[model samples]
Target: MGGPSEEPELWAFLESLHCGDILSGTVTAIERFGVFVALDDGPAHSVFPGVGFISFAELSSRRFEAASDVVQVGRRVSCEFLQFDTWNLEARLSLKATQPDPFQLFVDAIAVGEKLPGQVTKLIPFGAFVQVADGVEGLVHLRELAWTPVETPSDVVQVGDEITVVVTEIDRERHRVALSRRQGSSAV
Candidate 1:
């Protein structure tokens, strides 16, 4: 006779999953904020739609107009477990983790002082964020915006403006790229 039947075995399988574990699943649903996935050979989550969920930002390494553009319902995907949301009883997953990071590729392909054309995507008090590649963005600090001192970033660049910037620093660990528009200028 079995001491505790297969209950303990089932519990062990569910508990074995840890952060960074790669799991395969089918996309069950898509929402404005995230995607629901029904994991293959995984225990059902008690509160969420399925065993896993992927946030919008975790869906891809490249920017897309919508979640549907990146993944469709019934799409099979391999995702990395980010965390187990114990309160929500959901597995937080990242599809992008399985894919190559575009930012890393961009950094590897370029070097410091290389001028690249980018579009101004956002303006903030400290600087302007420019989209240098499909999913890669670099910050142009206020002091680097122009040769002349500028009180605000908007005074130098505006949203949707096409500009050239030179890579000043690359923080691969933090996935940050510092850029300088002033250095891109031929006058300097």
Candidate 2:
């Protein structure tokens, strides 16, 4: 969602579009949060320059350092329409929707209790994220980080640390992988 537009023409144009429709546009801006596109078939906006928007999370199915890594300003792109952002009066588009999801592919080949190698990518109070595959990061909850009690994920693993983890559970519907470090070490 984004700021509302005062142009009624822009709203009508965006309303004409539906989810899953492929729209081609020129990348008008790339902000920290998302990318804006000037749709070739849509009317001009009075508030924002473009009425088509793709959030960072919708830009790619893979992990990226920045928006530019996946798309650049002035580049032409085709994106799948996700929804009409009535609040922002913009078309919510998804670049990743047009691409295959690596997580689904990873899950299809992995099984529960399978041990795998991964690099600790992030540490939080609740859990640690491990990059088990490209675009596939599994959550190693605070309790799963070690057998003994730990205050935080950093107490067991730091960012960039190589670790072995057991895939304790997989929620296909939610696209989540639950991992356990203690179980992995014990299995070995």
Query: Each candidate's root-mean-square deviation in Å?
Result: 4.3, 3.7
lDDT of 1 by residue, 2-21 (tens): 12244444344446788899
What's the lDDT for all of these models?
0.86, 0.89
For candidate 2, the C-alpha RMSD (Å) to the true structure equals 3.7
TM-score of each: 0.80, 0.79
Which candidate comes out best when scored by TM-score?
1
The residue ranges of model 1 lying beyond 4 angstroms of the native Cα positions read: 1-13, 43-47, 61-66, 83-88
Worst 10 residues of 2 by lDDT: 1-10
Assess candidate 1 and give its TM-score to the true structure: 0.80
C-alpha lDDT (0 to 100) for residue 177 of candidate 1 = 97
Cα lDDT tens digits for candidate 2, 119-150: 99998889999999999999999998888888
What residue pairs clash in candidate 2, if any at all? none
Tell me the lDDT of model 2 at 135: 90
